[model samples]
Target: MKKRITASLASVLALSTLVACSQAPAGGGEVKSGGEKKEAPAEKVKLSVWHNFSGDDLRAKAVRAQIEKFQKDHPDIELDAQAIPPDGYRQRVKTVAAANEMPDVFFAHAGTGIKEYFDGGLLQPITPLVNKHPEWKNNFMEGALEALSFNNEVYAVPINASVTSLFFYNKSLFEKHGVAVPKTWDELMAAIKTFKEKGVTPISLGNKAAWLAQSSILSSLADRVTGTDWFLKAAKQDGAKFTDPEFVQALTYFKGLADAGAFQQGFNSLDNTQMEQYFIQGKAAMMIDGAWALTNMAATGTKEQLDQVEVTVLPSVPGGKGDPNSLSGGAGGGLAISKKLSGKKLEAAYELIYTVSGPEGMKAVAESNSVVNYKVDVDPTKVTSLFLKAYNLTKQVKFTPVYDAYLSSQGAEAINNGLQELLLGGKPEDIAKKLQDAQAKSLGK
Candidate 1:
């Protein structure tokens, strides 16, 4: 899933723009004891919020409506919402933060990189407000709160929840070729072989951005075949090493998938949109992706075409301790309240967050096949059977946060390079060793 790109970019551009214009956000508001203030009688509060939502057109439309509704409901408060493309989001966030002109509130994840905003006192922590609102946690799944917490404070409200990083396949193709959905690694291999023999691209993958392929496919395999918890613990060097058998086996298994021609030709040349096009067009039999892909596919395909598509978990190895039901993912979309806002503006912001995670916003998201973190009663009528099935499937999983696991400075670069090298024929042991060493060095800082 793509985090709100617009929000980050807004922070980036707004930072410099604000400085160039000699402006400060909401006149440099201060935090009180409870970090909230009553409506200041002197001014009508206006705040800017940013998000990078690059999904369904309907999803964007819904966001627009949500903002309008928020403004209408709280006439004294106004919100400025902006969306940005993912390409420049990180750069924008960094540039804006550097300029000391961040937006009042913006969308961001809840890992080490995301935490840097709060750690540097650039973003406001919402723990006090959250604690006062017990209803907030009720909508969230168990353990979902852990990702947003650091040193005992909650920083963000989770927006999207991932079921599992699995594959999306054309059900029609599977039945036409008489290939059953693979349940185990051997069976998955056989299915791929059958599809290849049938002249169909077994899997369509776009790796141009790197993260898409690594997150949806390689990481899925690593977490499924190896132990998710074990691998994460090992990567951090907390209690295990990358050279452990589990890690090696996982890497080797992924390499085998590559050797068997599992992905489309020249995968390295494709991007997420391009690869998704191939799968939705029926040129590819399956695609390793997340729940977000389902929404993307549905947008391109008609009702009948959508009916022909199905999703399944990543297959497990025969007799492997890893379970096919075990998923690798975390809540993708999250919303955070800024520590800077106090009084009526913050109240309005919190109101917006609550409505979005409440029955209404959650329903709209589910209706589009996007999973939300709030345990808000999902109107089965709003969500497709496919989404319902995926949601239920997550209950069977033994999950470990995938992208959030690597906490070191070199962790991302090392993992990305290691994957590219492994695909280019480097040994699994070498990949693991390099990652371990780089990570160790980062941890020493």
Candidate 2:
């Protein structure tokens, strides 16, 4: 998994070396001139941060408030923040890393995304920090800390956790067509057929944004059929082959949906925002998305829109390995400090993570209809039904696949691209073959 992500990030940042370069070792793990270690001065240091969620109105406001509060408490530390869109954030981070100008503190993913940076020696190990600070350790969610650790070293903090569920059908459309919410793949197909008969598209998908396709559909299907551990292992080729029955089943199911016209025309050109707009405006009957969509659905949807929407996990395939209740999700979205900053900068960085993911920050996240891994005392009244639903579903889900979690940089791109190709025109076995070939080549197997 690590190798796949490395390749993916490398391609994403091919032209931008600034962020990727900091990954290069300047000297040995020890200080030079060397009888004794040389320490850099730590007083009144300023650290820079880069994040993709910076411009999101509510998220931005929450982050800014946290920063302001942190600044007030730690007057000696200064932080500079830059926000970019999530789509372009990876390249920008790579540019900074390549140029050896990484932020002292920045937000990064916990899975393959951070593994590359950690392997490159560009991220600081936070295990000792978490160990020494018992308060931070005690408050984290179960399994949260373990997921963020690579090779026994903690490198990132989880700010939010999400499990991907299959969201489909407008209640109005379903009733109008007399179609029921599906509990199984066959039932879902029936529902799609009903929508098609009523001149409404069954499912709206935007694969133009590559990752969305994997996150929304492929990942969810993998969860339903293979369970999380196997899925993760498969992506890493961890004794699981691309040609495994579960992989074949997922590919076949995905293609069957496409062939049956489950999606609208020009799906290849559609992206997430457009897909969301299609569903929100009632142009489509259903969508497969994450819990984050709730905030948007509520904010932009009308009373009619609100009435028509419902959330649920994807239907199970007949005779699939995983239970219908098992879903896809992980402590994937989170924050981490860059290895670059120290002294006051380091202290300030930790403060930022603590504030956003801690009690006060988590409350804001819950209010925003998001999920986090904090165990702080909560006022149940403060959380929305969306979170409540997601929370319950997450507990039922015992696994998350490796394609999203374990594969290295290179593997992620190959698998995602392979899936896209299968959707476009490639055969399932051909797709699997390509994946096997790519893994063999990339991993030098």
Encode model 2's per-residue lDDT on 229-280: one tens digit a residue: 6765666667787778777777888888888888899887887777877897
Q: 187, model 1: CA deviation in Å?
A: 1.3
Residue-level lDDT of model 1, residues 144-197, one tens digit each, is 767777787777766677544766788999999999998888888999999999
Please give the distance, in angstroms, between residue 443's alpha carbon in candidate 1 and its true position after superposition: 2.4
Report lDDT (CA) for all predictions.
0.71, 0.71
So what's the TM-score on candidate 1? 0.82
Candidate 1 weakest ten by summed lDDT: 23-32
Q: Any runs in candidate 2 off by more than 4 Å, and if so which?
A: 1-43, 132-139, 340-344, 375-388
lDDT of 1 at 131: 72
The lowest-lDDT stretch of 10 consecutive residues in candidate 2 is 27-36
Clashes of each: 12, 34
Model 1 vs truth, CA RMSD: 15.4
